[model samples]
Target chain A: MKRSIWAGLSGAVCLSALALSGAAASAAPRVELQTDPPLSQIEPFSEPVIFSLKAVADDGQPLEDAILELLLNTPPKTPWLTTDFPVVEGTMLARLTLPAPQGEAQFQQVPPIRGSYQLQVRVSPRVPGTFEPYTDLLTFQVPENPVKYRNLAILLSILLLAGLGGGWVIGGSQPPNPGEVASRPVQLVLSGTVLVAIATLLYISITAERAGAHTEAPTGQDNYTEPLNAEPVPTNITATLEDQAIATVGQAIPLEVELTRAETGEPISAAVLDINTTSLEYERTVFDFTAQTDTQGEFVWEQQFFDGAPHLVTVHVSPAANSSIPFEPFEFSQRIDVTGVAPPLFVRLVSLGYCTGVLALGTAAGFWLRRRSTQHAL
Target chain B: MYSSKLSTLKRAKQGVLSVPVQAILFLSLGSLSLWMLFFSSYPATHNTMHQTRHHTLGVGCH
Candidate 1:
């Protein structure tokens, strides 16, 4: 139950993070940054939490010689030790050690700030390099409960739709219509199905432990990190992600790959980016095939993951394309974690009941109409 | 003869309304009632947590 609560909270955090980042960045520099002990882990009055930042490039490469800057903001209500979140921003960080991979620069921040914290990573080329310094910006927060009772609110809406619709059919129908006789078989089937659904749901409700209602097995990916932006940039290959950060289970989650010239952003219509899905016994491969990009310089491969295992989608852009960017045969991968929570069985059963009841009632309404017409004729 | 003529007129009127037409009309009327009730009560119920929000409010206003 506690795990489920944690998962729900984390999933919400992930959603909000996406919302905060915006769908696409207009001109975000390639320097990627990640801070550990995600904002969700922050609470009021707790010990000053140290947010360790990891810096990398767009490709899966460790970024060295990066400079990190931090500013801590204090607002009202920082309690310093409690995880009650509404209270915890009170602890002061004794020191922050930013890793240069070769050297260290340290700093300290005062506790209990009420505003957002800003972290910036600036990467300077170390090896008498041809590359110029680039910067990436990240904003962190201890978010508030924006909308309380979210699930309960959605459930109320579903029930209202069902109730009003059901009431209409029930109140309108009368006997002695032709459809009443003709629809008997269908009515019987629907009735039986609804009864069975209701009984099964009831049995499960009475028997099954309530742990499934709120256990956190699969953590929500609301952890503030963008692998696409944080990964190491290969010398010659440039790849782009067609976002599917909002896909659900059993639905086709498409990752659109476009090979482009890093300097010009022009599509490499002839380049093929090979895809290999790192998942379960289902070692499926069309995503792994090397195919040429069309005139648009992009192709999409969709995978519908069934079970709740974290799968990494590894994409390798073939280095055959001619480009000014020194392309190494490096690969970039994103993990498709468990983000979707399937509707509970009880909710599904209620939905089934609504559907079956509607069908039967609609038939009855037809019969009632036919009977009225007959009466008028007589 | 007059009665028979009246009956024929009545039959024509009834004939104009086919089974499908009657069924559609009846169902439409039912749905309309539901829609009116739902829309009218939704705002009050949503805020006040009472399904008969309009009814109670109407009583108070009177």
Candidate 2:
């Protein structure tokens, strides 16, 4: 009896193990679906539509030898779906296709209509009896026809060309819109502001004379040669230069000084007039000169200049009072060298050209508008 | 007594190496390898669709 019971237990355990293994062997298969040139509900007509399919085994492993079919089954009402739908040749219905090792197995084709479409994939559909087939379905839309813009593009191009031609006709050599140039509000305001600024500067300059270093003396050296007691006491003195223009660097320049005796009210005869330069390097070397003034009571000294230098020359005049009369310090200066200091010629030319082009374009616009108004009136 | 114990150990090792035990291990290991190799997540399948869209747009599919 115990042997019979043991045999029954072993038989039951064996039966259960067979059942578990059978269930695992006959498990479900897997199917995957994909689309290429992906169906777009709203996209331009320039793009293409595509589809892809893949298959896997009961163990959820990709079944390489198994076949896959990517089917585009149209809806009932769609006239594009026909029995003569093209059959892909040489491609297996469920075969696993390898894409670039890193790419998807994709197929491309055009959609027949701009409407809803469906994609179906059947994996190992032909595998007889052993494993059930797997299928997947996907849906997407195709957009309607795009609106054409060809006419608008043409009209815009014509307008741009016409404007260019009108510019050429009105931009001929004369000043841009001469009438407008005369009437331009900005030009008038700018000129008025400049005049006011100049007037203010002149007023300040004239009033500044009072604050300037001034000495009083008689007008002529002969008046200074008279007896010292006869000369009137100078209440105010003024001196004027013969010229203000000086040459460029490395050029010799002459500076003249007019001195008036402070007490005499007339120019005093100077036994000697001396001119001295300050520490500022005006020339390669420091220079000092002394000379007797002409009857006009003017003393002049000529000196050479160095480039990019500032010079101050002081004129000291000795009067009959034995005291020297000082004149305002005069400065002579030269600009830096042209090669090192000047801007490139091309840049200046480009700026000038740009200005000229703007002026020409402005005139052209004005003329075109005037013509357009005249035509409208007629 | 030592020879008897050694014979018993040899018999036990043979039982461990029996055909039935090996069959169980082979099937389990095969199923495990298949799951690792081909039982990828559904996300991977969706990713492939995403990659296809990127390719159509001439952009990064990766």
Docking class of 1: incorrect
Best-performing candidate as measured by DockQ: 1
Docking class of 2: incorrect
Over 4 Å off, model 2: A1-30, A41-46, A56-60, A75-104, A125-131, A146-378, B1-62
Writing each residue's lDDT as its tens digit, candidate 2 over A101-166 gives: 111245443342344556655655333654565665656666533332343234334434433443
First chain TM-score in every candidate?
Answer: 0.29, 0.23
Q: TM-score of the A chain in candidate 2?
A: 0.23
- For model 1, the stretches where C-alpha displacement exceeds 4 angstroms are A1-232, A235-237, A280-287, A320-327, A340-378, B1-62
lDDT of 2 at A263: 57
Clashes of 2: 18
Shift in Å, residue A363, candidate 2: 47
Candidate 2, position A245, lDDT? 44
